[model samples]
Target: MVNDDPRVSPEARTRVKDAIDALGYRPNIAARSLLLGRTRTIGLLTVGSTAYGPASLTLATERAVSNTGYGFRLANTVDVDIDSVENGLSLLLDQGVDAVIVNEPTSTFRHRRHGLAIPVLSLSEPLDLSDVELVVGSDEAGGVKEAVEHLLGLGHATVHHIAGPQEWPSSKRRREAWKAALEAAGRDVPDSIEGDWSAASGYEAGLEFAKRPEVTAVFAANDHMAIGLMRSLQRAGRRVPEDISIVGFDDVPEAAFLSRALTTVHQDLAVAAVRGVELLMEVLDGGREGGTIERVPTRLVVRETTQAPVASS
Candidate 1:
């Protein structure tokens, strides 16, 4: 009856249902899983509590999970070190999750699942983990490549970069792509400024840029840093797109309305999250092999922050 066997008498099913309805009984999902050997639940581990990418991806995963008729649990962490990740997953597993999703693992993240018995998926930068079933994220390298190319097409002499922490896979990919784009075009590869994906760090880099009049174009790894860089430039009396052109990744909500609208790379965070969960489902279905990475696409978003460099009279 629990299996809903078609051979079971329909009247018998109705009687059991009526009895349960009369008693107002509800099946305990966890207990039911114990009996059936499948929980149909997924655990999610998000990177930062307030970071834009992780936050948006979290919502996407939740929506996707709901669509799949599965329950979920979430854990948020600021630290992405291997030990911290292990602890986070341990907590989720204690909740009896049948599967797990690591929302945004840093590049420096080391994989050690402590002999995890269930399938593992990640919505972070694609790190080919031998033990993981699926890894997925936006094509950060492609996005940055496009962003840099766009700025170069605008007649800028060179496009500088403000990158996220070096430890992060996304930041590293973007940084490498930016460098590769510059080299491919025979443009000088300038040293990149490092940021913590925070406006404060970008502002710090901006403070330095304000002193260098040679900087005409810049690409920031994320939108928050872009906002910081722009605001800093404004304070230094440098006008965006007029005195300095800028491009950022991750088209955050307010990017369009910023004082001088932001030009950015639009990463479909929600789509990536949905894809990760879908991949997880495929893995759980037992036909797909592990180590597959699905790359979600990203596009360039032109806005007021980018333009052709002003010609010197």
Candidate 2:
């Protein structure tokens, strides 16, 4: 008998009806899993807990899963341990997770998805999505272009660049965009210094870059490195903006309150996390195997760190 009580919402009734329509039994999702080959649960693997970006992403992912009314199995690794990562994934699979979201950098996660029956989703960093069903990445190139364009709009000379490791897809994209913008503007594109996505690396690079007389404007690929670069420049007797302008990517929390402030590209990590979950859930919901690439937009935030290059006395 169909119960059409006023207290029961139509959506609730519809969900119950859908289950009945699927099969003659009115079993709960857990009971139906065996018959339908669905686990009603998701797995998320993330990087070290120490990193702010990854930690925030983990929280966002958990919230997304909870909103969907699905159980989640989460694992965090302190270091890049392939064995531990694989072990954690194996355990999640044992728990009957319907899909997996791997927050590891793309390159590492790509190789690990081999022979997995369920769909795998990768967030951040570029990877060979051949194995995984879908991958979501930040639009780093667009962010770099936006940052450079803002500096140019401020009447600064061509922007110099400090790039992260060449192997990281984000770093490569930002560096390419910076160079392309310079070429398009007919500005001299100096060779960019490399950093290891760390403030110390940025500081070291900044020290050397400060020696150049023509380096009036600089852009660092990530916020940590940007701060380090700024500090190094200051320690080397260069005044930000007044002496040489600077911009950075990532727009981390500290960017605004820094001594000179920071003009940076803001990559919306929360938005990216939500989009990644959306794409991953789409695949897990028996949708068509869609294209693998999903690119989230980025924004440029103007601050006190940038100004017109001062004329050398």
Candidate 3:
């Protein structure tokens, strides 16, 4: 009755249910897995910070897994190093998960042998691993292009950039895109200041930028950094969108509510999560092949933080 066996009589099932309810009984998931030959649990191995993007993706992926009537497990890695990634994967595999989703946005897994027996999906750039079944990522290049173009269209001679850690593939993509856009428009590409996807790092970068009087427009890799950069600029008596226009990535919930609302890129993390699970399910059902890559779209949200650069006297 606990296993929902149709062979059990209705009266027996009712009695068993009543007894279970009275005793607060719980079925043994391990025993169930032994009998069914499957755990019906999906595991997620996330690498890196608890930043808004990673955290939101984790929640969205969990919800998508739950909506499909499957159990979910999570394992975290302290860093994107090879040892940390392998340890995280081993933890998930030890849990006997049906499949694994690796939210590793770094290049640690590229061209490496994971030796995973179960299906694996990645939420980063497409990797050359035979064990990885699929790859799903956001259109970071497209968003960066839009932001750079918007700033250039506002008559800014060039747009400066505050990039995320160079180790992350997404950060590398954004930096490359920003550079490419500037080069394509015949604009001089300035050296980019790297941040650790933290507001403090952004503030530090902003302090250096504030010293450069030629900087009229700037784009931050993420909103947290943008917030810190804005504060530093304000402390230096530089008004946003007046002295230096600012653009940021990841349109977090607070982006629109800031005193000077952030103009940023919005990534559809929920859609990416749902599609990743859906593709993993297809792999589990033996209906899909490995090595498929999907890129989710992103949009630029124009807000108060961006405007035409003021004419210099």
What is the per-residue lDDT of model 3 for residues 13-37, given as tens digits with 9 covering 90 to 100? 9999999999999877778778878
Residue 279 C-alpha lDDT in model 3:
94
In terms of lDDT, the poorest run of 10 residues in model 2 is: 105-114
Angstrom error at residue 251, model 3: 0.4
Cα lDDT of all candidates, in order?
0.84, 0.78, 0.89
lDDT of 2: 0.78
lDDT of 2 by residue, 84-128 (tens): 666666777788888888786325543443557777777765344
> Which candidate number would show the highest lDDT if scored against the true structure?
3
Candidate 1, after superposition: displacement of residue 116 in Å? 3.4
Tell me the TM-score of each prediction against the true structure.
0.87, 0.81, 0.87
Instruction: Answer with 2 or 3, whichever has the higher lDDT.
Output: 3
Q: Which 10 residues in a row give candidate 3 its minimum summed lDDT?
A: 106-115
